[model samples]
Target chain A: QQPVQSPQAVILREGEDAVINCSSSKALYSVHWYRQKHGEAPVFLMILLKGGEQKGHEKISASFNEKKQQSSLYLTASQLSYSGTYFCGTEYLGSGANNLFFGTGTRLTVIP
Target chain B: EAGVVQSPRYKIIEKKQPVAFWCNPISGHNTLYWYRQNLGQGPELLIRYENEEAVDDSQLPKDRFSAERLKGVDSTLKIQPAELGDSAVYLCASSLVVSSYEQYFGPGTRLTVT
Candidate 1:
């Protein structure tokens, strides 16, 4: 099933911060974050594995809560380059469970 | 290393027409995936392949959509008699492995059904 994302869209001024939340009903073994600009392919940002894990790349960070089966992506000091649709994909572990399910997505627009 | 590659960046066709999209995964990647994205939505997996074997295809529209990764390097997704609703972006992704590995995506082919 597709995970749910909160604040479907948000606008941020340069230097502002924003957070996108993704929640899934099923337990997640890992969560993957990606960003996609208009008319472009999605680019992998970071991946958070199970075990109360957290990961970050530069100004982008994410935290995964195993108990809640949810994850959140944090964009700090947003820049124009950060304007895009962010998607969170969750992965589960089991026999024949190698696929990643993505969330509805949060569109972020940064203004100067 | 080069990233995943997809062909025919854009395609415009009429309903009932057939269309095909090609994808070449990153070198050394062992897993490939096909996804479809509608306007303002996240991509939904249509199928995934590990090497030459189809590991998952539960979301594929088997009736009209078929995909093949002949050599486990490059893949092809075909839609015969495409419908209006098929007018969306077809994305291809690859990873070192499908089991808990990060995925790299291609630019994708935008399909327009008139």
Candidate 2:
């Protein structure tokens, strides 16, 4: 099943910080994060496996909570180029298939 | 070290027409995926392939949508008798293996049906 993302949209000024949350009804095996700018492909940011591990990518980081079936992405000191739609792809447990079910998305706009 | 590649970055077709999109995954990648993304929504899996075999296609609309990954490298997705609601971006992605976490995506094909 697809995950649910909170704060459907967010607006931030340069150097600000933002948090996007993703929750799934079913158990998860991994949570993958990606960002897509207008007219471009979604680029991989990072992935957190089921161990409740947290990973960072530059100023962006994400945390996965296996017990709660939730993941949160942290964008600290956001930049103008960070304006885009963020999506969380969830791989459900016991699905047996290596497929990702993506959430609706969170629109983030960083202004000067 | 090229990323995934897709053809026909944009396409416009009328209802009841046929359309096809092509994809070439990064070299040595063993898993390929096809996703359909609608406006204001996240990409949804349409099909997935491991090497030359289809591993998952339950979400694919079998009545009108079909896909193939031949020779374990290139793939093609076809939609026959397209409908207006079929307008969306088709994204192709690949990973080193089925269990690989990170998937590299290609520039998607934006389909507009009139």
Candidate 3:
């Protein structure tokens, strides 16, 4: 099953903050975040494999909640370069095992 | 070093025609994957290979779609008698191992079935 991403689209100013959430029904082992610009391949942002652990880069970070089977990506002080579609790839415990099932996507537009 | 590479950035073929897409993954990656992405949708896995053996192909449409990874480094995906629905971006990704969730993706081949 595919994970569901919230806020199908988001518009923010260059220094604003935004959050993208991904929820799954299955028990997850890991959550991966990626960003893709128009006509470009998705680029890896971060991967959270441990429960309650959050990883960050620059102003972007993500947290995985094992109990809720959900992941949230946080973009603080968003930059214009952050304009792209964000996707979350989830790895679950069983059934169709060992695959990263991705979410639909969240389009983010950062205005100057 | 170099990232995954795919040939023919774009392809256009008439329905019922045969087409093939090739991929060369990053050096040393042992796992290769083929995913099909429809417009406005996330990619769906078509097939996955560890080395030269396909371990997960349950999502692959066996009747018309086929894939092969020879020598465990390069791979190819082929569609015979393509249907209009087959028009989509074909993405190839590679990782260090099956459980190595972090993947490196190629630019992908945009196929158009007319």
TM-score of 3: 0.97
| Stretches of model 1 off by over 4 angstroms after superposition | A95-97
Q: TM-score for chain A of every candidate model? A: 0.94, 0.96, 0.95
**Residue A22 CA displacement from its true place in model 2, Å:** 0.3
RMSD of 1: 1.2
lDDT of 2 by residue, A77-109 (tens): 999999999999999887855589899999999
- Candidate whose DockQ is highest: 2
What is the C-alpha local distance difference test score of candidate 2? 0.93
TM-score for each model: 0.97, 0.97, 0.97
RMSD of each: 1.2, 1.0, 1.1
Assess each prediction's global lDDT (C-alpha) against the native.
Answer: 0.91, 0.93, 0.91
lDDT of 2 by residue, B3-114 (tens): 9999999999999999999999999999999999999999999999999999888999999999998799999999998999999999999998787369999999999999
Put down candidate 3 lDDT per residue, A7-112, tens digits, no spaces. Answer: 9999999999999999999899888899989998989898898554689988999899989999999999999999999999998886544588999999999999
DockQ of 1: 0.77
